[model samples]
Target: MANTSNKVREFQRKLYLRSKQEPDQAFYSLYDKICRFDILWDAFYLCKANKGAAGVDGVRFEDLNSIETSGKLIKTLRAELVEGRYRPLPVKRVQIPKDNGKTRNLGIPSIRDRIVQMACTLVLSPVFEPHFHCNSYGYRPKRSAQDAVICINGYLKQGYQQVYDADLSKFFDTIPHSRLLDKVRSKVTDRAVLRLIKLFLKAPISEPTAKGKSRIVGNPIGTPQGGVISPLLANIYLNDFCRKIATKTPCKIISYADDFVILSKTPFNSAQQDWIKNELEQEGLKLNEDKTHIVDMTQVGNEFDFLGFTFKYIVGFIQHTNYVKIYPSKKSQKKYKDKLRSIVKHRTSLTLDQLVERVNRVVRGWKNYFGKVGYPRQVFFKMDWFLVARFYRWSRSRSQRRSLYLAQDAWNKLHKAGLVYLQPTKMKTAKVSR
Candidate 1:
């Protein structure tokens, strides 16, 4: 069983690297492998339980079938794992020898607060169109590569139009650690907190590893290049920057993470841009110019991506297809069910009727705000589709009465988007309201 798991990990890594190169083809291949693996793993588990082989039971032989059925085994295996009852694995702690008799533990929040105060802020530009892609999980759109282009064009539009863009020297390492620490100490007047900050400065360690090699660990300092908290932290810092700028001049700051677009109505001026750049320099962050651009109105494209939603030149021209859809898979229905099961497992006490109330709550909000925007079918997104389908199934699966609120919000949202028409679903306990 361990060996089988190891092989699965190996395949996942190789596939991950390959997918980075050829995402489209690899997505299909990886998706198929995951599906097939799930089916076989389930079969093997049932067979082993019947055979009384409580342990390994030579699951590797079945796993070897991973590449079979056009790698259907691998696909099934991953899906099962994602949906399986895997317990949280224990983490290994590393011991680092102290230089003297004292060691300090710097709490990230303490240091982060200080970073925000001392660091200069940057007001990024607003997202316009074609700059971001959709993420179904977060239920938000993300910036696309072209969005970067629009960012530069936005700057140019305001008259900081420069023909050249440049990169910073030692962008990441140049952050002034000593100054940052000092700033942190000033913000939090606790001695113990200061001690922690002091220790963190001297003992910056690589991120904690959970399992497996080749995992990219984050460098300390609360900046997760791609983690959830990173954006919030960056936003805090940038907000301070914008406040400072707004104090001295007029500029609006808008951002989705590090990517920024600043609007200055003060005419096309390099001085403001320069001052903005200088402020960022004080804190260690720098803009990459090789990727930056400056374009006039003619150069401005009609669409861009910002804040996860695609912006088109025309009002109400958001392309929902790029933002929401069930992922490509043969067992869409089953996968969707598994998701709902997990949701219910976590929320053990929620009754079907209560769930109905909750979903309807969100639906009510949708109706009040976006009710008249588009057709009911267009309103519901992939998230709505999956959630609604799951709740409907759950209501039927359980003999006890279940509520229907869970599906209500998603359904109404989907309906407003013109994706589906109004349909009444019969719940166990009561008649679910649309």
Candidate 2:
């Protein structure tokens, strides 16, 4: 572990130095190496081992796993790349059911498609990672929704009064392909690689309809919703917009993909709002007017959900001032509860150990996510109570009538066994709790 840590630190130091000296050289070298047969073979094997899903071509990982088959596959891919005849297969579109009785469309790229995308990403990431703005935390390595929330909290601590929550309407789907390609062309000049990217972008698509018909169509604009490279391209395309906003506006913007919140010391004037709207429009993007609003955190005092976190200004009685408090949003909490309820509802089908294992899995994950927020003790207590209550309810519903002590005991056993864990913390001293 120590050696690994030292190696990582050394690599980071080298990358930092190289980025300062020649920004594009490192990426160009990596890209050149990645295109080599040995490196591509290694990448292909890695992708196959990860069990990447097949694309519209229906080429499974197993078919490409063997030495003989992988060699043939690599040769064919290279030929296609050299001849500029490589075309991404149509993405498999599927709808995933959401909790709100709605379905979200997901595009599944093929195994070969993913292998190529992953190889490119591996080479490009080191170069692009440093250029991404600190405020923009979407689809980047070593960052998450929580990082954006934490950034916003840091700004709130510095006396931001209002937060303008901006939502991009169909951001990914509406990105003009020409504009995206223009941005890509600025950074990458290799004709063959550019051709490969163009092929990926302009690939034909087929979406299944409700009537069980496949509608073949061409996507001349927006990136494919579920393609491996879409998020990376989106980030690159939006980086310019984010840079422009940082340079021109007085507001601090925190973005996670299409969701953005602009924090300002004062509410945005009409001109400022128009400037933002116009900037996006120039990029062929539109703001979702219904979801965009300037919130006065001090006045409203109501929690606003952003990136799964509930952000609100709570009065600090101890300090006699306002402080931003973050918690798991009610919607997220409800989902957790609903999942637990489902597990408890089926508790009779499982053994005691299995039931405890399931509960512990859920609780541990919940704590890992929400425990970082301030004043999580009360929330943890509530969750504990909820679990105990559900267990009792499940028992009583079946006329078993388990004692409250027994139910509590079961929870305590899980808690003590290190299955269900919450952060140990003291309650806040006299503050408005929400």
**Candidate number achieving the greatest lDDT relative to the actual structure:** 2
Pairs in clash, predicted candidate 2: 54-110, 55-110
Q: Please give me the total number of clashing residue pairs in predicted model 1.
A: 65
Candidate closest to the true structure, highest TM-score: 2
Error of 1 at 92 (Å): 8.6
Q: lDDT by residue for model 2 over 316-418, one digit each (tens)?
A: 7877776777887778878889989888883477754576689888988888778865556776777766776665566555666444344445445555545
Task: For model 2, state the Cα shift of residue 185 in Å.
Answer: 1.2
Candidate 1 C-alpha lDDT tens digits along 1-434? 21234554455456445534542331211223323443334334333232321111223333343446425533543444355421211111233333345432222222122211111110011111111221111112254333443454455445542232223433323335555544333223344333433433333333344563322232344332322223323433444454565467655444444555554544436776687778877666677654454322223233333332333223234653221121112233244345445654433577655555555554444434333222333333443555556555554465354555444554454345433212334323223443
Q: Which residue runs does candidate 1 get wrong by more than 4 Å?
A: 1-175, 200-240, 255-260, 266-271, 290-301, 315-434
